[model samples]
Structures are given as C-alpha cells and as structure tokens.
Target: MPEPIIEIKDLTKDYEGKRAVDHLNLNINKGEIFGLLGPNGAGKTTVILMLLGLSEPTGGSIKISGYDSTTEPLKVKKITGYLPDQVGFYENRTGLENLLYTARLNGISGKRAYESAEKLLDIVGLREAKYKKTGIYSKGMKQRLGLADVLIKEPEIIILDEPTIGIDPKGINEFLDLIRKLSKDKGITVLLSSHLLHQVQKICDRVGLFVDGRLLAEGNIDEMAEKLFNNKEIAIKAQVSNITQDLIDDLKKIEGIRKVSYSGDWLIIKSIENVTPAIAKSIIAKGGSLYQLSYEKYGLDEIYQYYFEGGVRHD
Candidate 1:
C-alpha cells in the first residue's frame, strides 16, 4: 500500500484528571474511507481533535502525510479539511458568502474562492440554495454548507465528526453518498467518525470500534463477524403436529446453541459450529415437518454489538 496518509502512535489525551484517549495507535492509507466508531465519550472525538491539531496530546505523536502535527501544524492544517461535530455558520451570511469567507480565511484569493465556492455548492447539491442566508437553512442544508466550506481548501484529507447527525434519513443517505464520491473520485483520504454504528457499518471500508477511552476492535465487518459470531445463524420454518413448548425447551438445553428465538412459523437458532445438524435431528424426533430451512449470515450491526458488548477485546 502507499504510505499511510495519517498515523497516530501511542496517542493519548487527558482532561481534568481523566484520560479521554489512551495510547491510541492506528493508520489510514491514502484514499481510504476509514471510520472511527464509538459511543459518546468513548475518546473518538478526542482522537480527531488531536489529529486536527485542535487539541494538545498529553503523550505520543501524530503524523499527517508525514508532517508531525506537533511541530508542523501549519503545513498539516493546509492539507487537511476538518468539520467538527458542531458545525457553525454565520446566520446572517448566505451559503455562498459563508464558503467564500472561509476560503479567504484559508488564504484563498477572491476569484478562486468564489469559483471554488460555486463548485462546492453544486457538488454538495446546494446550488439552488447557495445564495440564501444560512439562518433560514434547515439542519440538512446547513450540513451541506458546512461540508462545502470544508472542501473550499481542497485539502488532501477530510475529517468529518458525526457528519450525519441531526439530518433526516434521506439527507443522511445523500451525505454518505457524497462522502463515497469524494474518496473514490477525488482520491481524498477520509476519516469519518460517528456513533451511529449502522451508518458507519454501511459506508466504511474498515472500522475501529472504541469503548471506555480505548480501541476495542478494528477490522472489516465480515472478519470481525467471523471472529466474534463465527458459527452464524440458522432459520427453520416448520409445520408441527407433535412439537410443543417442551420440545423448544429441550432444544434450549442442548450445548452449542447460543440463542433460540421464534418468529411466526420460523425458529431462528444461532449456534456454535456444526450444531445445526443436532438441532435438525431434535426437530425430526419431535415429529415437526420442516417447511424451509436456511442460513443467514450476520450483518455489521450484529458484529458491532458483539464487540460493543465486550465479546471481543482489542488488546
């Protein structure tokens, strides 16, 4: 792989005698959509803040595109576009004006800033509302405007904190699509942080799960699932003449079956490896006629919950 676009080594942050982040280490490759996922106060925000040079690290180092953030902040900032959780905008300024003003702050000149603003507004689907005062914009529109402002500098890396927060479901879907396009088409490395596990599960190529101020697990969803819920789930639909609650209770007593839940005519059995055959035998002995039997693979949400509930530990 090309050298990592962002690297953190032993990164830690402390606030009021509490360690918000602890010995965090990770890497983001060039043009990859990496996700930082955790519950609130799980140290995700602190990691992003330190990476962006907006907060001081109590220990360790951060390197963005080979430039040390501690010593080369200006150079790093120049090539980074960051949108924090609370994206602020001047209520009185039009969306176009907000973008132009931010560009100027980044030292972009008049004509170029205007042109960039227009392009970004169109890119983010805000062209029709580009000249409207931001005060009148809805949450989703304001988010689009914030994203446009972040892109104004045309940075090499984009760090988004809870980018989909407070937006409607449709808006969230649109914003995620935009993020995918940015990484795939523009070759920009992205570090998207969010507490919405499902959203992160959908878009991220790889995800790092955090809890209690530490990274608990990190990997692709399928790998994580296999490592956590390796046996997978089995669903059986049956028509029974002699099956009873006693049979279900007896099946529950068998080893290897992790979970058994019924849905309409289906008995869903989640078990360890090779246990489905035993379940089948038990059902046959109970004289239940099987109508349908199938295996369904686990999704990212199930895998994430496995880690979140302390089923796996990173270190």
Candidate 2:
C-alpha cells in the first residue's frame, strides 16, 4: 500500500480539566477523501486545530507529509489548506478580488495571480459572481468561494470543518461535487469534518466514526459493518413477477439462505452472505420476472447509531 499522506498516532487533547481527544489514531491515503464524522462537541474541531498547528495537542503526535505538526508546524502549514465552518472574507471586496488577494498572499503575483484566481473561480462555477462583492454572496456561494480560497494556496491537503451546515440540499450537492472533482483531478487529500452522516457518506472513501473525542470505528461502510456486525447475517430485497410458493421454497434451499418472506411487493431474504446472483438465477429459472434486487448495505447513519446507542462496546 502507498504511504499515508496524513498520520495521527495516539493524538490526545485536553481543555481546562477535561480531555477532548483520547488516544486517537488514523491514517489518510493520498488523493482520497477521509470524513471525520461525529455530532457537535465531538472534539472534531479540536482535532483539526491540532492537525493544523493552530492548537497544541496535550499528548501524542500528528504528521502531515512527514512534517511534525508540533515541531515543524510551519512546514506542515505550508502544504495544508484549511476551511473553517464559517468562512470569512473581505465583505466589501468582489469575489475575484478576494481570490486574487489570497493568491498574492501565497506569493503568486502579477498576471499569474489573476490567472490562477480566475481559473479557480471558473472551476468552482463562480465565474459569473467573480466581480460581485462577497457581502451579497449566499451561504452556498460563500462556501464555494471558501473552497476557491483554499485552492489559491495550492496545498496538497485541504481540511474542511462543517462545510454544509446550512446550505440547501441542491447547494450541498453542487459543493460536494466540486470537492470530489478537485480531489480526483488534482490528487488532493481532503479531511472533511462534519456531523452530517449522509453528506459524508456521499463523498468520503472512508470514514472514522468519532464520539466524545474517541474514534469508535474506522473504514468504509461495508468494512465497518463487518467489524461491528460481525458478518452474522445479510438481508436482500427482491421484486419478482409471478411469485409462488414453489419459488420461495427454491430460494430458501440455496446455500447460506436462512429465511425468506414477503414484505409488500418485495421478497426479503435473510442470509449469511450476499446471495444476490443465486437468488436471481433461481427467480429466472422459475420463470419469474425480476424487477428490482438490492442487498442490505449498512449506511453510515445506521452504523453510527448502532455503535453510539450501546449496540456495541467502544472497546
């Protein structure tokens, strides 16, 4: 496997007399989106702060691209871009002006700065609003612009915190699409910290479920499901035409098939493994028309709820 672009080992943090992060460990590969998922006050922001060198960790270490966040903070910041939940810009400055200013700060000057800023504006679908003052930009518009701001620095990694809190559904989709496009096109690693499970599930390649400053689980949805559920059973739903008792009996006879039943217009099959193909073959052989077939894939929301609500021990 390729070396992880970002690494955190036994990372812990404390505020006042309470611990905010506890023995957290994670690794993020290059060109992949890693979601840090949890609710409010889950220590997500604190971890981000430590990673960015904005706050010191009470214990443990963080390394970004091989630069120690604590000792080589400047080097870490040089290759990392951060977007806070609430992005701020010069309200009186036009969108283009804001981007140009950021580019200048990053040492890209003269015509190069303008070209880079304009390119990012177009890439983010904000070219028309480039000349509009940011004071009039909506929340979604600001979030997009914030993305453009982060890109101005040409950082290898971008950290976003609560990026879609108040945007409408359509806006959220568009913003997320832009993020995915950037990661795929530029090979940038993204650390998206958010409380929204569904939105994170839509873009993240892998997720770390965080609760009360601890990482309860980590992996893609399917991998996590196996770890948490122990692969005990799988549920499959199928819609077939001309269903009969004989067809149901045949399905149950298939190896690994445990139980078969009818729910509404769908046949629900509980099995020890995914037997979708076998189920389909049986349906076709029995002269039944298959309309829809889907297997139970655990979603992030279900996994989060199951683990957090005492379905499993954190240990």
Candidate 3:
C-alpha cells in the first residue's frame, strides 16, 4: 500500500502559557477528504497552521507527501494549497490579475500563467467575472477567486479552513460540488476544517472531533451512528385516547427500552431491538388503548450529541 499522504505524531502548539494544540496525532490517506471538526477555539486553526508550516510546532512532527514539515518545509509547501476562513485580496486587482499573480509566484509566468489563470477561473466559476475588480465582487465571488489562487499551482494537497463559512446557500453548494470534483478528477487530498458538523458529514471520508485542544473522537459517520445509537429508536402515536404520563412510564419498563419521551400525541422511545411488539402488547394488556407503535430511525443530529456527551477524551 502507498504511504499515507499526511502524518502527524504527537503534535503540540503553545502560545505563552496556554496550549493551543495538545499532543495531537493524525494520519490522512491519499485522495481522501479528511474533516477536522470542532467548535470555536478547539485548536483547529493551530493545527492547520502547524500543518502548513506557518507556525512551528512546540513539539512533535508533521510530514506531508513523505517530506517532514519541520525539516523540509520548502518541498512540503510546494505540494500544498491552503484556503483560509477569511480571505483578503487586493481590492484594485481584477480576478484574472490575482490568479496570474499567484501563478507567477509559483514559477508560472507569461503565456503559461495566463492560460493557467483562465483555466482556474473557469474551474471555480469565475470566468464571467474574470475582469471585474475584486473590490466590487460579492462575498461568494471573492471566495471563488481565493480558490482560483490556491489551485493555480496545482498542489497535491488542499487545506481549507471553514471553506463554506460566510458563503450563501447556493455558493456553499457550488463550492462543495467543486471540492468533490477536484478530489475525484485531480486526486488531490483535502484536509477540511470546519465548525459545521453537517458540512463535515457531507464530504468527509473520516472525521475527527476536537474540543478544548483535545481530540474527542474520530471515525466514519455510519460507525459513529451505530456506536452512538446502536440502531434503536421508538415511535408511538395516540391510540384510542390521549397519551398520558402513566402510560409513558409503563412503556418505559419494557425490556431493552433506553429512553422514552412524548412528541405531541406520539410517544417517542428508543430501544435496542424490536420494541414495538412488546410495547403494543403491554399497552393493550394493561387495559390502555393501543394507538400506534413503530421503530424510529435515529438521525445524525441525535448521534452527534452522543459523541460530545459520552466521547473518550485524549488529553
């Protein structure tokens, strides 16, 4: 098997007395979209900076494409592209000029830079706005321009911090589609950092959750879903009469039932197995009318909560 494209061992970063990243460890395979998920101030930015060689790790090491970030920063940077959460562009420069300038900085120049600029603008949906001054462009357009700049070098790895932050609904969708295409067509490995769980859920092959400088959990969504919920949920609708607290309590006593709550006239319950039959039988046998009962499908939101509430800590 090919070696992993990105690897980190016992990574750490500190600012004065505070620890920004605490002994972090991560491995990203080639051509995979890896999500670094966490809430605000969870060391996401610190990790990205360390990975890109913008800040030196207080301890540990990082390797991109088999080149150590500490010992081989130049070679590592040559194959890496980064898009920051807040993009700052020259207001006076046109979209085409920005792309050409970036390409030139990467050793692409003259006709080659022009052609590359045009191609990247088209790829990022900025072809029509190529000549427009960035000052007058909308937030979404500026983001697209930033992406064009990042791709001008055709780097093997793309590190995006809050790639969809501040983008409108349509722009977010477009950017996501573009990322999928880049990964599939160009085979570029992506490290996406975002606070939004749903966006990570949509694009990540695997995700690592972090909190307060600690990695809480890391895995695929399906495995997380099963581990958190264990494939169990309960649904109960109003039977012949209105649902009561006593009836809810009685249903809770059934074997395998984990939690029971009321949703309007329906009783929501979660169980490990076929709980409907037992619940229905119990309700009818106890002289209470049976309205309806069925299995409930666990949602991602519910499962996500399980991780934060019950996740293992790595400190």
Q: Considering every candidate listed, which one attains the maximal lDDT?
A: 2
TM-score for candidate 2, residues paired by index = 0.80
Number of the top TM-score candidate: 1
Clashing pairs in 2: none
CA lDDT of each candidate?
0.83, 0.90, 0.80
List the candidates ranked by lDDT, beginning with the highest: 2, 1, 3
Ranking by TM-score: 1, 3, 2
* Model 1: lowest-lDDT 10 consecutive positions: 233-242
TM-score of 3: 0.85
Q: Which ten residues in a row have the lowest lDDT in candidate 2?
A: 305-314
lDDT for each residue of candidate 3 in 118-181, tens digit (9 for 90 to 100)? 9888888888899998899988888888888888998999999998999988888889888878
Error of 2 at 47 (Å): 0.7
Tens-digit lDDT track of model 1 for 1-315: 467889989998889999899888898889888889887878888888888787899999999999988878889999999988888899998999889888998999789888988999999999999888999999998888888988899999999999999999999999999989888999989999998988897789888887767876678887766665545553334444455787788788888777677756678676654566677778888878766566556766666666677546655
Taking the tens digit of each residue's C-alpha lDDT, what string does model 2 give over 1-315? 867999999999989989999999999999999999987898999999999899999999999999999998888887899999889889999999998888887778899889889999998889899999999999989999999999988999999999998899999999999899999999999999998899999999999999888998999988888887776677799998878999999998999998898966689888888889999999999999999999886666558766667546568
Clash pairs, candidate 1, are none
lDDT value for model 2: 0.90
